[model samples]
Target: MPTNVSNLPPVRRWVPAPVTKEDIDWADLTFVDLAKAKTPEGRAEQVRLARDATHRQGFFYVINHGLDKAIVDRMIDIAALAFDDVSEEEKIRYRARIKETGEYLGYKLPQYWHIANGVKDRIEHYNFPRDVSRREHPNVLRPFLPEVQRIVEFTHRGVLNEVQKLLSLGLELPENTLPDLHPFDETNHSFWRFMLYNPRSQEEEDKTDNVWMKGHADHTSFTAIWSQPVTALQIKDWDGQWRYVRHVENALVVNCGDTTEYLSGGYYKSAVHRVIKPPSDQDGYRRLGLYYFHYMADDVRIAPLLDSPVVQREGVNKFIVGVPPVQETWRKNRASTYGVTQLERAEDGTEYEVVNGVRVTHYN
Candidate 1:
């Protein structure tokens, strides 16, 4: 959930190690062709690629996902209209009050956010829930609601479902294993976001030491971003180096998140990533992005699904079941990031835990 309010507490500045030729070790990320994945002839290779991508980089590109071109185009067109044509007043008319719904839906105007570099990010976003029928308030852009809703539903039913099934196969679990955790029949709390990063003048960019967004891991299972020509997204490498994620035509970039990492018994990683100015050639353009975040129902308790082959061999990590509901974790992460003061952290203390032999954030 996002708001126009500012309340982020002080944190350390983000100064990544300088980029060097040797530090830049990898060439390109693993790309999976969904069309190939669905074919009997290519299924085995597809699964192998999926397994390597998830376990090694925790991020990959998907092509031939079977989304109708018209739907994809419409989604992008509507996003541009929302950001460019719609007035600020119009956006405010539909702004979501998180305090009221206890959920992250609605317009989130740009606000100051201290990143690892200790500079506020210059970005704004509009978040729409996956199920339009469950929306508590009407969107001001009502005229386009039909198309918008269709796109969200299509992404979920078309792309998300297939990716989940493919990953399940790669994990050696039942085809429905991951999908069962996220049933379409339920009121899924997943959301689609339309975001814009305002272009910065050279002087303005020079004045700040921060990147567009501080490096952080998504808290969902996996995040999907529509490929756009503008390139500004970056992902941290296994060796703690930052590298650009090149944009691929008609491909959706997918990255594992915290929940997936936990559910996979730490076999998969929650890739740390951030946005920054595109390479010099693309710097003049304002960056527009579309993202779909997929997650299990809020009430579902998340932990290692103990029966997975990886868990069976290596055992479960620190995140045990029945600690807190998925929604609680979602709320806590959002509240902490946005400076929302209404909710306080539960008295339960934090814990230092190891995953893949490295310490990471964990709470019991």
Candidate 2:
């Protein structure tokens, strides 16, 4: 049986050691300025930063990025408008539906979402993907204001382009690591936008419940997040300390994803994180954030970093080395929340079940 939210242990608080100037490894940091990354030295530095930060903290902040401030503001404006303009009935129109077997659309509730059993996430989010063609089995028509739709498409393509450039640099691959054409087959690539809201209400604030996201790691290649003034994101340091990641205007938070860990052969870390519900009016304010998840193409093989043979050998002994040939691990991770059949639908619209740890997909 799943554990009750209230029964979960309280989050332990630990003071973090202050980050000093000397401790700051400039080599491991990626500033948002791409022009700076254009020169040979600049490109070298960017790759170093990407590799080091992923191996060390699995997260970093980017400033001076090319994303337009105007576009970002407009996106946030649309989010607020959606919350305000869409009637409760209209919002419910997009609520996911289950097919004949009675599985609600994909992962929904915090308590029931894919992940290990834990308390529900305190955050509420709106999900949107970049490209939707009829060819895609899971593609469903979603309601969006015309202006919002335009912005979503523009931002999605622009951000993806930038991400591809960064990936190419870090991987030392050809400029078209992710070609103009889709890198992964339609079945593999995953991209989505998540508009998260952290609202404060008396009922929510006063509840003595542990209804918040528990510590977990993402299942993708990387996540790019941009936020407005509200601050609710925090990172757990290696020393078991929680550091509040203050949202600087126009900055993007970049973090490593599960695929990156696999590709790096475990050289880069896929850090665990959680969302904490802000205290009600803790200084007379609430928080809001927008997150973009960049997933690896489904079929991309993940392998450990080539340089660290010793650690790779150790990892093999520990059963953490080498890329698993199939998506069994990924499927198993989501099964608890999405159920075998529902996860299959979301992945490829086929009925799949794991019998004896083998995923058997049934196609009509």
TM-scores, all models, native as reference: 0.80, 0.65
Off by over 4 Å in 2: 1-32, 97-122, 132-188, 198-211, 279-286, 303-364
Number of the top lDDT candidate:
1
Over 117-218, each residue of candidate 1 has an lDDT whose tens digit, in order, gives: 234556777787777656643343555665667667666767777777878887789877887777665546788888888876565466544366656677
The digit string of per-residue lDDT tens for model 2 on 81-166 reads 43444455544655434233232222222223322222223344445444433222211223333333454444345544455566
Candidate 1 residue 157 Cα shift, in angstroms, is 2.2
* Candidate 1, superposed: residue stretches over 4 Å from native: 1-27, 98-102, 116-118, 136-140, 201-204, 207-210, 320-324, 327-364
Candidate 1, residue 225: the lDDT equals: 90
The candidate that wins on TM-score is 1
